[model samples]
Target chain A: MIEVLNPTAGPATGKIMMAERTGTLDGLRLGVIWNGRPYGDRVINSVIDLLRQKYSFESVTFRKKPFIGNVAPASIRDEIVESCDAVITGIGD
Target chain B: MVDRLTADRISVENLDAAMELYFERGWTDGLPVVPPTEMKVMEFLDYAGLEPGRPLGDVPERDRVITAEHLAINAVMAGCKKEYMPVLVASVEAICHPDFRFNHMATLGSAWPMLIVNGPMGRDLGFNSGMYLLSSAGNRPSSTVARAISLLFWNCTESRPDGIQRGQFGNPGRGHYCIAENEETSWDPLHVMLGFDREQSTVTAVSTYPGPYQVYCQRTANPELMLDSMADAISTYDFYRGTYILLVPPHFAELFIQRGWSKHDVRRYLMDNCKRSVADLKRRGLWGLHSSEYDGFAGVAQAVQPGDEDRYAYVFKPHEYDRIMFDDTTLLRRSDIYVVVGGGNAGPRLCFLAPYGVSTDPMTVAVHPV
Candidate 1:
């Protein structure tokens, strides 16, 4: 018989569970965090504008990460968390 | 002693079955890996004088805490010898550094780590710093050492294609990123230049694009003309431009040395001379919809040279592009470019590893041999 160990760091620990779904978008504050890629702002803002035609939002906040190659800074995160109720962030090209 | 291994061990009927199991589990890098058996993992830890559970560091962005046990298992699977444990451990620490930006590996840019090994340890381990150092010529120490790190990228950091590693077009550097700075040079070795003792071995991990684009400049001995050729290749319009690494061959180094040009002199020349004009700089290569307006040239990823009215290229200075009426855009500073002398004395060509645009500088860490 032969034995070998698992290669990965195994499952990640201290995983933050997915936040509860807001159930609905109407009357909720909308936050959009776009990676600073070209036209990303346009792609996101256009969608928010479309959504606004269907449902009323208390307010909408737009934030751009400092750079495309970094995580959002704490100040930006605080602004989003404090001013907005839900966020929409995009990934990959 | 370190924390006992907590990883579950699976019993298989034969080696082939174990390999099959590894493949099914998505543990291998599409190649045969030595089964990381219990004894081998413990031996690797002992060679590095590390406990199994000792946390090397955390790749916080990936939400992974790399431990000595994880390093050992991956190292053994990559077919590395026990003696290579220290180098692998050191490389992990360097890559985990915030400045190194371990989190940004998975992107359309497809940036991977290039390890520049220095000190006597490179020689002791028979790392090929000569011809084909970057090729798959089976230089055991360098290949296995780099492979071990790649395994870490796969297993611990989730660099698999199906996983978080989203490279638009990946290259072979993903498998093994050529390392081992040719210590046999007229100038101080890379480690010494990076402020380390001549005796202490170290590894510097830089987030680099995969291709080591070769710059052929053997016709003239003049340093200025050589920079004209090399600097043209270095100055590019790729995703963007930041720091660059130039592998200067011995013959190429001779041309500069004969002209009384030190490494710093070569860097300063590239910085001051290579600049692009303000008109050329107006085209937003990747920033806007004007990528097509790049001087009627298609895929001219190399940064646009100085346009008419201005006479400069790329060498990046922190000046406002619109305000500079007479100056061309600069790409990087003297300190941003790292020139290392390596490769066999025979080759007339040099290699350049370009950066992935705006990124934190590559970080170097000392290899603490046990």
Candidate 2:
């Protein structure tokens, strides 16, 4: 029997897993991070507005990464973590 | 006995069944992969003196760590000879270099990583350095090496055409594009210019979007006239571009050499001449006015300048706007103009344009032969 070797490097994993869902979208502040894409701000803001209409949110914090192509700087990431209960990072193009 | 492999094993009835299974699992690049049996993989790792668990590189954004075994398996599947393992290993290391920006190549642009081989091993390994450098004509090592890189990107990064690979019009070069410098010609090889010794065999990996754009200058023997032709070829690009490579063949290099100009001189000339005005750049839709309408445009805009919203294009003084805009601003400073000599040594002078933003840096890694 011929045995084929696996080529993939395996799936991605991170030390810090995403916060578990609290099963409630009420009174939680949401963070919106724009990745410098064109519609990223508009699309994310629209999502926030939709969320606002459905649930009562304490506040919505907006943060944009300083540059594109590379990962967001630590300061920006840290600010998001410290200020908001949950975050939606816009990560396209 | 060979080192025991730790990769998950799947017993197949035969080679044909293995190929079918790999296809079904989406492991292949829509092409048949040679069954990467345990024997072949072990042999491949042994040829390169690489441990199966050796970490070649990691794509942190994608959360994937590519190992020696991962590349060896794909290299074997790509039909590479056992001896070709070293080159593949080096290439994997090169692309995963923080500067190489392998992740960005998988984005919406038609960018594919092009490999440029240098030194004696290029000829020793039988890679084509002359005419049709991009084609797979009777050259197994060159073509298979390139194909193996694509498979690595696919299997490791998970950037498939239907997935993360968002090229608007992905070119065929995505599969394979490898060429060597024509050493026979009396011109400076690319590695030498990059400060590497001429004798060392190195593989320089770069991201070229939409393959190479060949610029032809047949009648013009004058250096100024010839460079003007080349400048005109790249001037019309609306997006702010950077890190373009000019593959100047022997004949063209001869003209510059006769004029007592070195590769530095050619880069200086192009950096001075190849330019577009700020008004022209703005007209190319580089301004943020309506950039968000397209998904691809949005990403490029964001990556161009992440947090700064107003200053979308390169900031030029009012007077500077009228003057030509070099991607690196004051030219010849950054790794902007990369010159390599190749082709039939005659015919229309060909140059390749590899565009990367200010955020990414290109790299050259020496292929350590066993």
Candidate 3:
């Protein structure tokens, strides 16, 4: 019998814990972060508009990442964290 | 060896059966891999003087910390020799360099890591810097080192097509794409030009696009004429403004080097000439301001009509794939061209390619072998 080692990085740690959902958007502020993907802003703006019609939003803030393919800067992320109840970012090619 | 190893080991019937097990586990680059037996991995780690838990680097966004154990295991599976370990390790670490912005590997599925090895190590180890440079051509170091990095991309970095890797067409370059620089041209080697000692071996890993498309200039002995051909190819339409890399074969290198044209001259000349007329771009349907970056044409929107060739092309939107800059578009920024010499000894052919989805640009990491 031949013995072999598992070649993968093993189970990923990213999805190990799920974030707590606010559960309702009736009075939540929406945070939109666009990573410079094509048409992502339009899609997110449409979603925000739909949410506005379906439920009351305290406010909506939009932020563009400094560059695509890199992490959002702390300043942008901090503002979103402090000013919004929830945040959404997207990836597009 | 088994007791010392921390990775989980699976028992299989034989080498053939081990291949099947790995295939079933989704751990290969769609090719048969050598069974990463405990002894094999142990030897690789030992030769590299690495402890199993040593952290090579990590993809912070993915929360994946690539360690020595994983690299050693993957290297063995890719059929790499112990001597190739240091180059391979340095390559993974280079891409994992936080600025490497590896996520593009997923989003731009058409991309793969292309390793450009520099210095004496590659030459001493027999990595091909000559004919059929990117092909295996019976060159073990060239083929296996490239494959090892590719497997790491697939197995460790999660560059699998089924997951996040989104390249519409599976790029064959992803299979194995690597080449050593032919420093014999007597011009400064790429490493020295990038500020490394001639003695220091280094590896630069680039997130490559679809091709190392051949650029031919066989007709002329005039360096300017040859460069004009290369510049034309570089100006061809593409989705993003990518940094360009040229692989100059020996015959092509002799044309300029013999005439005392330094690498700087090549870079400046290409920067000045690697442009296409707006008329040509429009005829090809590659000209437009579809990006938000061009929302107002930076106040010169009037200068751009159907085919003006007015302003030098620049600025692009993130989402728009085809629509590009206006005016006579200069494809390469002054510092955007990276020229490295190495290819077959006789071809008038050269390779013109570029990196895609870049942030901080490609990193050249020094290799430290044990």
Candidate 4:
């Protein structure tokens, strides 16, 4: 009999934990973080601008990462979580 | 005699059917596998002295725990001899290292792992360190071991081409890339340069942009003149500014070796010469309003406030200020420059250029013999 080992990661058992939903976005502060990729900040800023047009935001703050091709540092994450109601981070280029 | 594997068994009428079954299951790199039978994988595990479920390393980014059995299966499938298991195991450990940044293996760029074997064991395993070092003709063991890693990345971490490994311009090196440092040619073996003992055998892994930019230096043997040519290639506008591996063939490296120059000297020279002008970067559209402080223009962006037509006009101290140096990425500090010797005596031709980035540096792990 021939047997082959299973190389795939075992079944993906971790559940996706979603954040609590807030019904309204009115007057909530939003944080924007860009990972230093080209044009990521512009895209995020445009997104926050669009959000401002629809709902009134108490404040909007932005943070730029020091490097690219890396995960955000814990210190940055802490700052964003402490100051903003919702944070948006992404890659544009 | 080898015992049959205890993992789940699939009864196939013949080897051909087994190959087809594996292909259909997407358990391959779109290449013909060796139809890893029970005996082949068992022998590989035994050669490495590893238990079937021993955890080799984990790619937490992909939620994958690479185990001994998983590697053995892929090694057997990639046509690796049982004796090559220890090197294969060490290679798996190197790539899974957090410093290697296992997550970047899935990036939508031409980044892929380049494996370099160093020390005595490299020759014992028949790894090619001469002409066509990265090619199949130099060494089957090197190529097969590299191919096995590629297979593991695809099967274990789910980095298939059209899947997570989104290489915009896919390369042939993505399939297999491994080389043995030409230990005899260099002042020091790569492992020793990386802090391992002279006798120790190790594998160095780097997630790099695919394919090497070959540099040809025919009759000119002057160290400075040849290095000037290499520095120009290193500063090629298309080359990313980061850790670059220069595979200097024996004859080419001999130019400096004859002059009694050390590897450190080569690195310092390259660091001094491999730089781009700030104005060149701006002209290439790389200086778009980013917040990061560039080499010459520190805080110049904040100084040049918004809504100013001549924003950069005052930024230059003089017209010569535009000629100041800069790097594309800050991760590769001046000290991060690395060099190694390899390639056959096939002329004075070799290659060098930038790999992925500095976020993921070259990782080295010793290979322990069973």
Q: lDDT scores for all predictions?
A: 0.74, 0.73, 0.75, 0.71
lDDT of 4 by residue, B133-158 (tens): 66677367988998898887777777
In terms of docking quality, model 2 is: medium
Expressed as tens digits, the lDDT of each residue in B301-358 for candidate 2 is 3333333333223321222322233322222223477888877777876676656444
> What would the per-residue lDDT of candidate 1 be over residues B96-208, giving only the tens digit for each residue?
87767676677676888888888877778777787776766778778888888888878887887889888878857765674677766577777888899999999888778
Candidate 4 steric clashes = 3
lDDT of 3 by residue, B7-87 (tens): 888999999999999889889877899999888898999999998889998776666788898888988988889888899
What candidate 2 gets wrong by more than 4 Å, as runs, is A14-16, A22-26, A54-59, B1-3, B278-335
CA lDDT of B335 in candidate 3? 32
User: How does model 4 score on DockQ?
Assistant: 0.38
RMSD of each: 4.3, 5.7, 4.1, 5.5
Tell me the DockQ of each model, to 2 decimals: 0.52, 0.52, 0.59, 0.38
Model 4 ranges with Cα > 4 A deviation: A1-3, A13-16, A27-29, A58-61, B1-9, B237-239, B276-329, B332-335
Q: Which candidate is the best by DockQ?
A: 3
Which residue pairs come into collision in candidate 3? A38-B319, B109-B167, B110-B167, B310-B327
Q: Per-residue alpha-carbon lDDT of model 2 for A5-77, expressed as tens digits?
A: 7787776757436678867878887778887655578888888888888998888889776455667779988
* TM-score preference between candidates 2 and 3, better one: 3
Measured with C-alpha atoms, the lDDT of residue A19 in candidate 3 is 57
